[model samples]
Target: MVERMKTYKAIKYTLFVCCYLFWVASAVLIAVGVYAKIAKEGDVVDSLTADPALLLISTGSLMFIITFFGCFGALRNGVPLLKLFLGILVAILLMQIAAAVLGFLFSDLVLERTEQLMAKGIARYREDLDLENLIDFVQKKFQCCGVHTYKDWSGNVYFKCSETNPSLEGCGVPFSCCIQWKNESVLNTMCGYETQTLEERIAKDSIHTTGCLDKIVRWGKRNLILVGGMTVGLLGLEIFMICLAAAQISRIRGKVKTVNSRRRAR
Candidate 1:
């Protein structure tokens, strides 16, 4: 069986470049994770995962440092350790995939949490928006929180009765309740607020307040800027790796040529 040739210098250098980037990214992620765990820690593990930024940093680090470096032996000339290199690469990819899935699951959890916050926010806004008076009027007349009796008074406010529609008088306010009350229908307690109803308003506020994940991205970006600045260092390492590969290839080729020449002379 023909033996696979050793890795060429060009390929080794390319890999070196890739690996250095990985190491840097990994260091940042692990650092951030540690910092959070130490400094702020459990304060953001859940949301950070949801934003997926930290995961990216972690995964990126693994891809470059672990997988690329692990496969470095394959750069040898005249007998490629292709299998070993490939195995390491595959393992790292699997890790990345797992991280991605976990991140997505976390995002879903955040979304659910945001929804709960929305409910709470809407309830809170009710008092501030003077929605209780509206509710009282509706309860006294229609016994619901909807607009089934009155008409649009001004802007988003409504004055109506609950005699026509009894269903929306209670806890049946849709987030999209924009119907103009015309007859003896119930008046919605928190329906009219410019563009947002009670539900929408509350949902937005809750998510913004509770589920907003800007901090994660901001931190990630700041770290990435370091990564960006280190591009010069990374580039230099890549050049060195290429030079190392070229020298190795040259050394091996000279040996092979010498062996061939001796055989021909004999």
Candidate 2:
């Protein structure tokens, strides 16, 4: 009995540590999402469509609340709370499976929607400095420009290719679209200026003429194995925790039953 108690205690403490770390990670995710939303420069759109930050905040908040129940339920050895946690975890797992199936069935629609959201972001780039910086960073990191192609910058009024536009940046992509030279220490902010008006051959040499949508799609395809591996690993961890919690609950109940049997015998 003492050995059983020791084993139970060890499992409980280990589960507590794991759940506590999950809680902390969720909290950090929420904080980063909030900071991104609040510190964003310029116009704030409260629209809930395709905003990664909002999605992160929502997911993190949900995880934090659910994991709170799991952590405390294990620490206190509360049967009811543990049962609730188990139910929720199962439901979440099922929902994730359903989502994956749906995503596979409607991949084309998903890609189209993704492109639309990206185009919307580009259009609203000037309205939010944070968004602008984010778009610029994506372009630089991906080594791609615009949504479908560099010509898609015409969607942005500031970069619209027209001789009549008043903005000096008319027909010009952001500096991020410019070819980055290895030895060059300074970025020429105006490197993309007037490049949109040039011929395709010339523009391709100076700027990334390819679109980001295709590059992003390609990247996702290339890393499918990695993403799938991570997903499986996380699900495996969750299942292990559930099994651990269930074992602890059973151990406690059996010990209680043994004590009750002894009392009845006496």
Candidate 3:
């Protein structure tokens, strides 16, 4: 009985520590969401542009609430809070499974929606400075431009590549479309000037002619193994914590039952 009590204490404290760490992680996620919100303060588009920050905020808040129960319940040996935490954790796991199945079933629709969102961002590229920077960053990182090809820039009013367009940016791509050069110290803001009007062969020498979607798809394919590993790792950890909480709850209830029976017999 003494050794069993020691084992329960060890499990309880271990749960406390894990819950504390998870809580901190959720707090950091919330901070990142707030930072993203501030970074894109003036732009409020609800599509892909704003979804990331909102997702972070919502997920972090939910995790905070759930982990609070786990942390306090473990520390105080409170069965009610522990049960609540376990119930919510199970619900979350089920929801994740459902989402995965739904995503697979609606794969084509998801792809179409993604393209539409990207197109919207491209079309409104000049409306928000933060969004422009984000698009530029993605283009530079992936070494690709526009949605499916550099030619997709034609969808943007400012880069329509038409002589009739009055915008100074017409017939040009953003500097991010330029081929990055090693040892270049300064950015040439006009590196992509008139690129849309140039012949494909000629443009190939100075700018990325491919589209971002293909590059992004390729990137995901390449990192599939890594992403899968991380997802499994996180899911396993969550399951482990849930089990630990359940075990502790069982131990506490058994002790309570023993105490009540002893009192009745006395």
Best by lDDT, which number? 3
In model 3, the worst 10-residue window by lDDT is 41-50
RMSD of each: 17.0, 2.4, 2.6
Per-residue lDDT tens digits of candidate 2, residues 1-266?
78988998988888788888999999998998898887776446555554556766898999898889889988998888878887888888788889888889999998898899889988876776556777898999999999988988888889988878888988999999999899989988998988888888999988998899998888889999998999899889988888877887787788789999999999
- How close is every model to the real structure, measured as TM-score? 0.32, 0.87, 0.86
Model 1 residue 130 lDDT? 26
State the lDDT of candidate 3 residue by residue for 1-266, as single tens digits.
89989989998999999999989999999998778777875655555443566667888998899999999999999999999999999888888879778878998887788788788888878766656777899999999989888888888899988879998888889999999789888988888888887888999899999889889888988999997898789789889999999999999998999999999999
CA lDDT scores, all candidates in order: 0.42, 0.85, 0.87
lDDT of 1 by residue, 15-122 (tens): 555555556767777676455444431333233323234444466555555544434543444323334444455554466557657756797775566545433323
Clashing pairs in 3: 148-211, 149-211
Better of 1 and 3 by TM-score: 3
Pairs that collide in candidate 2 are none
What are the runs in model 1 whose C-alpha is more than 4 Å off? 1-7, 41-65, 71-82, 91-266
The best-first sequence of candidates by lDDT reads 3, 2, 1
**lDDT (Cα) of model 2:** 0.85
- What's model 1's overall lDDT? 0.42
